[model samples]
Target: MYVAVKGGEKAIDAAHAWLAEERRGDTSVAELSIAQIREQLALAVNRVMAEGSLYDPDLAALAIKQARGDLIEAIFLIRAYRTTLPRFGATLPVETAEMACDRRISATFKDAPGGQVLGPTFDYTHRLLDFKLAAEGEAPVAPTREASQEATPHITTFLKQEGVIQTEVDQGDTPRDLTREPLELPADRALRLQSLTRGDEGFVLGMAYSTQRGYARNHAFVGELRIGTCAVEMEIPELGFAIEVGELELTECETVNQFTGSKTEPPQFTRGYGLVFGQSERKSISMALVDRALRWEELGEDNMGAPARDAEFVLYHADNIQATGFLEHIKLPHYVDFQSELELVRKLRAEAEENLASAAANTVPEAAE
Candidate 1:
């Protein structure tokens, strides 16, 4: 049982006041507006939205401003605010084939259908920093092309047609919300994907990297990576028909792993899928790798005793909010617990000294005899 300690309210209030003052540093300088943060620090805002499980750019920017540019703190703030929101309804499954793509690329096929579109990427850029952006400058305009009206089908579709890749069959079951329901062991693919999409980026990346280092390695090849805006539709109770609620910018990744087949079954390439909010390509790829590693059981592969394969460990530890809460709580007052441990250690030492002294005394008498 935990007891609340009194008499520190004033100190706590003072600390909060100082924090606020620190957040608004240098009053002489122009304060950053929410718009500026939302537009300029987009990637950071995307990270906050992805991890916080919230999608409001304005609110994310506000959280970033309030948290003094701390992404994790912004995510925490967003998540705390999300609890007060009313749930209207769940959206239907998004169709990525209909996505208005900004960037699309495939590593498996060089001349894949729909062709490659490298949109607003840092992949081809040199590592050198541009000093011109150090001072005030006008926003640079980018070159544009005529928007294509063609639908960009997934590369996996072609592979599936050739019967080279494993086919995915929807069970038609309502996916369990990890936020609402307790995460049970032996989680389904849907639950695992939900957890991973909102999971800590660094943690997921590390787990994925472990797989590449031969810990439950699946020899993954990026079949397709696409970033685009997809329409989110929801069924309105009053209307009785599904309507577009909003559009969400998403990054989708499909990885083709080594052929896994048994004597009874023919060899077919397995697949690992990842879908995340915003242009989080790295996170999406990492998620796919980790997802594939966890699917060893379903794929009928041997357990390699990898951390990535341990579903419970990955899911539980992947949540930064929960991990940080437990970690930061250790900084709180534990005087009673510490005192108990201190007393026990002192008693043990005293008893050991007494026993040593008694043994010495008995040995001295025996030596004299």
Candidate 2:
């Protein structure tokens, strides 16, 4: 007779209280405010917003704090919260070029129309730990970069002038959201990028690094990496016009990759694109590289069967939230299945032992006879 396990209600309540305590940590230490998390842990908040597909920095920060700095948990919280939030309407395509540039730069050109403004990058900073920061010392003043009136056009656009790079038609179409929909194989550019943005940063970086190191050698140049706030516009049919809804921080990366001429087409340099939430340059760059690698088949290139080249491989495995949730869920109870397996093994062993004994007895009797 099997008895159903009870005490889940009490266990759950107790766990909730204990989790609250754990999240709070030391009783004497001052509790972390959502604002403090939002301001102090801005980058974490940014990553959560980007990956979570939610735009609210404050809520992301709060989730981070609530999750005790577990970024994946924070992302999960943001995703869950976003589901309940009322959707006013879909926003028009964000003009990233027209963004209020916080950080903008071009590697392809020495000087672009919008001159390279290396804004808020850790690129040149020494990797040494500061003793003063250990005690929460005052931060250095923000350095001002002079803004340029002449808008710099995208480097890829310039390459397209001579028919060097693949020209993309601005579908100006609606892009898909991977968070809301289940990811299917053979994804479009928009869907692939969405998966990569919320993807395991380390995994994406390694795959991108692999392409650079010759797993699928696609020579790529970083045409541009831009980070800034862009206004989100939404059209209201009732009002008969699109209005500025709000602004969001975006990190956009454009890469130029080498491509061979197709049988029916002339040789051309191909373009790979990546756009992420917050200032996720690493993710964006990695995404661009992977994006280029995936397009090899479409461009009529040879099949190298690289990790990045496999759409089913990259898209299916990139999501850390899904990976971790499934991986970590094994810790939950499955004793019934375990016991069943144990019983089957025991039964099999007993039958094998009986057979062996019978064979031995028969052999001994035959020899005696």
Candidate 3:
């Protein structure tokens, strides 16, 4: 029961004013700029872009600043803002093979076609924090290298060539956009990938972790993980040709899972693919694992009754925006509904007490006799 409470316009306005004041903080302290957030807090901006399904780093940074460093709140702001934008035509699919990779690594092989290029990553850094960063001195410049023009072939291609991995078949159908259309159950790989890419990082990570803990345990090896910039092309109606619209920073992950074979079919490795906006390696890897787990039916494997294996459960609960909305609705004025539940509980307790008293009285009379 949603009872409309009236007459708090002034209070609401004052509260918003106070919030703005608090967001500004002390007068003596220097205010943070949007550029500072965009550059320094790049990871947060990337997360907001990935989950919000928007690729604008500037807008993401602005949202972060507006949200006072709360990432989920920032994502919420980005998502709300995304609704007002006009729909443009879809771009051509990005080619990861021709990506100008900043970082590329394969755990499955000792070395791959492109070789390992470990770019701006904290993988090798010590966990200890450097207090020198607090003093705000000039930071040491990182060594630069000439950008490689060579194409980095996908690691899964090698396995596929060896006839060890299952090959993917392109249906040449347009993928359904959940943003434009409502998500129906029994979603295809394309729809599932879309959901996972835009899904809550934490939720998806948890689901992926669940699979690793023997819940539909598929032995997955990271075939390749690449982060780089790729050109985006868009088709022009007048020219009848696609033109390069922009470039996007993306992280792509490919996982080679355990081989599946039967009496008739030969053993072949199954593959899981993940691609997301910006340099979101963790999210991409998690997406791959969950993607593989969800493919139990398609892969002709037995359903292990795992939450990750349940497409409906995973897809429905994966979105943080939807989950947050449903969860936060309880915080709103539910006075009528709560009061009804409270009254019912009290009535049941009172009835039980009355029954107990009646039984006690009957027992006392019997004892007296």
Q: Which residue runs does candidate 2 get wrong by more than 4 Å?
A: 1-6, 146-150, 352-369
Q: Cα lDDT for residue 369, model 2? A: 50
Candidate 2 lDDT over 1-369, as tens digits, reads 444568989998999999999999998999999999888888888889987888888999989988999999999898888889886667788877677777788888887766778888899989898799989988999866654433446777778888888877878778776767899877888888788888878888888999998878878999888888778999999999998978888889999877778875568888778888887889899989988888877777776878888889998898888888899988877778877888899999999999999998888444665
TM-score of each: 0.94, 0.91, 0.95
TM-score of 2: 0.91
Per-residue alpha-carbon lDDT of candidate 1 for residues 210-300, written as tens digits (9 for 90 to 100): 9999989769999999998899999998999999989999999999998658644468898898998888989999999999988888777
Q: What's the lDDT for residue 17 in model 1? A: 100
Candidate 3 lDDT, 31-148, residue by residue in tens: 9999999999999999999999899999999999999898888899998999999987889888889999989999988868879988988899998989999998888988987556
Q: Give the Å error, residue 306, model 2.
A: 1.0
RMSD per prediction, one decimal? 2.7, 2.9, 2.3
Worst 10 residues of 3 by lDDT: 258-267
* Ranked candidates, highest TM-score first: 3, 1, 2
In candidate 2, which residue pairs clash?
A: 113-152, 114-152
